[model samples]
Target chain A: MNNDHNEFMWLDEHHEVSLDEIIQLSGLTHDELHRLVENGALIPNNPTDDSWRFNSHYLVSILTLSRLKHDFELESDSLALTLVFLERIRTLEVQLQRSQHTNSAPTIDE
Target chain B: MKFKDYYEILGVARTASNDEIKKAYRKLAHQYHPDVSKDPAGEEKFKEVAEAYSTLKDAEKRAAYDQLGKHASGQEFKPPPDWSSQQGFQEYTFDDIDLSDLFAGFAKGKGRTHQSGRDRPIPGQDYELSAQISLEDAFRGTTLDLGFTVPEYDIQGQLKSVPHAFKARIPKGVTNNQKMLLRGKGGKGFHGGHDGNLYLNISFVPHRLFRVIDNDLYIDLPLTPWEATLGTTIKVPTLEGAVNLKIPAGTSSGQKLRIAKRGMPKHNQEFGDLFAVTKIIVPTTLSDQERVLLQQLADASTFNPRHHFE
Candidate 1:
């Protein structure tokens, strides 16, 4: 079926996900969630606000964390530590892509 | 249905204690988790391990599974006639009932139930997919025919995959791997629950004319020896079209001539600069006339490229 949407928003800096929204998205309990944050998996842009929100990119990270938590019986703190390395690997892959020269230019006929 | 030996799957003894089962499960899970493991069969192996563990980890589910008479691995078997009389399972046709689903029903007794699983509403699942567009399309922000399988809940709360196709207007200035979240366009939520998001990870197809680094574009501009020395204005192809670029006198190979606002669009409606890297090309074969002219120039001109070595 054609489930077309005329408008869409990017999950960039402009779009932020609220704390409640993240908890719902991640399926982590409050205690587990707090441990994850305390272990440095998430940092809110506004920590003072009751409705502190996260950058939307963290949605991918949190979702990945959720899967890791479910698949492995590790504590949230340990999972958050693993998340740090995984995110690094992802960033390194992108950086690696940038460094390589594909040389896809067409040949000029003499 | 074919029977699966949970103990055999985990490589644990049937008489293994809870701690022993937990230890076995952890080792196998670590090795088979799709995210961590590099094995080709990791995902399927993980699912099998997880499924087996889910049933065995709980006291009630394990006991209920033990109620069923054990059979050899992969042996075809049906549930006992009086299984429906047991707790959690109603008197339903056993012809199509999966063993995992049956045990999952038993485990739900003291655990989470799908009906009451949400004290707070859970958002629907978000989908992430990649779309490859041309550099020109990325510069102009084109619409693409995008599609994904939407995970929806049926009337009985069972999950189903509904294939969905739609036109998506990819915004300009989105770099490779930049994620765009289409709000409420992901998997549909369960009864009155919040809708999920659709994440589109943008990637550009390799362009023949341009090499993109961030917002900027790089193009190789091949120049003749005369053009390099005489300083000629040549048309350089850009994403928009061709623009005349000045090749200054004594231009060297690998020197970049920049064109303003001719690259990919960026924040604040500003465009990045396009760089034309100069490459001095010489004729592979020289005719007699060309050879004589070149010989005369070689004899007259005293430009030594190997001056550094000297």
Candidate 2:
């Protein structure tokens, strides 16, 4: 029955995560990271910077990709396509939710 | 600990070939993988599938497991006195494997010995949980008190879930369906390993007065027919507070008015716009004097709403 209150940390859309952090956290190799970037599956925070930077969304993407690579034995080439489809599916689902919420409201006479 | 039938868990025959077992595991893993699947119980199911596969995929482990044949699933069973001294059992360890108490108990001492050589530290598994907040909370940013159980090992090397309490901050400008990651706040690490991260899949509770689309907010502004034709200024509700909106004269129902920089906040102090959609409400019951006046106005009016149909 320990009632210790832990410290709070805020992460927003603007959080910039470094590439080394992604590698360490996700257990992905440097070659695999390069392949994902080459295939356009991932985008760095800045294109010209010597060290790569990533946004928070890339954290979720890397986790999903690593699992897919291990479980399905998928290569980065195929992963690129899968990432595209996953993004599309996520966008559509969000759009669907928004429309459903909007439609439930009272309509006006046209 | 209760014995779990690995073959039954993977939906494979006990005599199934390696390829067949692998195929079944792959399909089930895809369906129950916590990263991809939306099922609430997916993580637990995936853990079971993975544990089963880890044992069944290895030839030595499979043969050793088969030696304990025909025990009913979930039946309480203990290994023989000399089980650890068996040929394949001695070399087997739980170094990088996350096993249930049943398997962990059997491999406890052996796992520690095998790990003593390499001393490789394995990070803890990451955890995900969903949180809901009010749209206003998302707008203004707020703190949430969360209570949940996280798994840890006892002094006896037995795994158990311990209750934990923490406060997490929901940052401002977070849209619905956004995810935020809290680093090193998940399950406890082992052997000086780093703790795993916690991912918060955020969702906003639907508001009674407003509807959110992307970062924009929308609301139905009801007005009388005269107000729609002869517009006036009226107070409108925004996330911050109330603001007066000037409706242009001759505004039509279903017309939308945008209030810039008054919607949900975004990065760099940017904001999406709020839209107010007009809805003209008519009185259901009118007095005789009002009905007469309406009739006169309608009769005198030359506007024909159905001119195209005519």
Candidate 3:
């Protein structure tokens, strides 16, 4: 194996995962996934195609929703709403963090 | 391994009913869910609660655990020699629980069952780690060397984490909190199973000169009073290299000058814009000629900056 510190393989957002892979990773059944897609909770990259493809970012959301559904026994509609609320919270948090940093003095830490 | 009291962790009775235990687990899970919780140790607490619930919720596992006797939490104890053979617990998949020190001991050759002619394959556990990168590095893709201590099972079935080092390239246009998955880079599988993936959570280190807002970049460009009033072309540093930026005449302090397509690189080679925010600076110490000229200018010019107030 090349152990060089500088040598690396670049990864990007384009590493699309298939529907079967998402199912395996998230432990969601075909029906559950279809429900999510119907509710606009899970969006495939190409919605028109028979085989669904999703960006890697959806993996985290799918996994989290699966866990929440398992733990809380939440219905599909409730799960969809919860996912949207959670995403909104995350966006607001990021905005708050940016505003905080902007207001402070920029210090260089060596 | 140190013993963990499941009932005590959940603040429930030793003889708590299954329904009661489930209720307690749900309450605690809601309180400490890593994504929603604000507590600093919420993730760790969440994992502990999950482990406790996984064992206690299952009737067989709970019975086996009760057979171990009432040991205090954190009390080190070893299982009986025949414990593995007696338990016959279901093979816990990686998705069920994290391989903590306690679970590592419990998982030792206890759940495997021969089927037809071959052993069943158990997929490895997914691992997560946060990585810090510079803003500049995120703009222009860079490679990083990361050291990880990963768990492996010895011949004796004892779990140990050995030090491993690997390099990964962070692609350009990676935003903060974005995760990159390295497939088959996590825990080793059992019985020729596929390895799990490594999820890297990216966090950008604070940059000295630039503040990244989404894909856009902002930098403070300090200019002299004269430079602000009378525009000049000045060299500005970017991630790629320095480029000359033209400041319009009569440019005021705090005015933002845009340089198109000079910011962070996005997917498909698209670029964000960079904004140079102007800051007017004055010399702290004035020479005799400079002071005489300023005094002359003060008497000569009839410009009032606070005309609105007047």
Q: Write the per-residue lDDT of candidate 2 for residues B58-153, one digit (tens) a residue.
A: 786787678766688877666555655672234323232233533433443345556463335546667778899999998988998876676565
- Clash pairs of candidate 3? none
Q: What stretches of model 1 exceed 4 Å from their correct place?
A: A1-9, A12-21, A28-55, A101-110, B1-34, B38-123, B146-151, B156-161, B164-167
**Clashes in model 1: which pairs?**
none
lDDT of 2 by residue, A1-101 (tens): 11112332223335666678678867788887877778877777786888887765666667777777777778756877776666566657767887764
Clashes of 1: 0
Q: Ranking by TM-score, best first?
A: 2, 3, 1
* Cα deviation of B204, candidate 3, in Å: 1.7
Write the residue-wise lDDT of candidate 1 on B85-169 in tens digits.
Answer: 5644445454444566556445332222435653335456667778899888888889989887664544554434567787888
lDDT (CA) per prediction: 0.73, 0.73, 0.72
How far off is model 2, as Cα RMSD? Answer: 5.9
When 1 and 2 are scored with TM-score, the better candidate is 2
- Please give the TM-score that candidate 1 achieves against the real structure: 0.73
Better of 2 and 3 by lDDT: 2
Total backbone collisions, model 3: 0
Cα misplacement distance, residue B132 of candidate 3 (Å)? 0.5
- Span of 10 residues, lowest total lDDT, candidate 3 chain A: A1-10
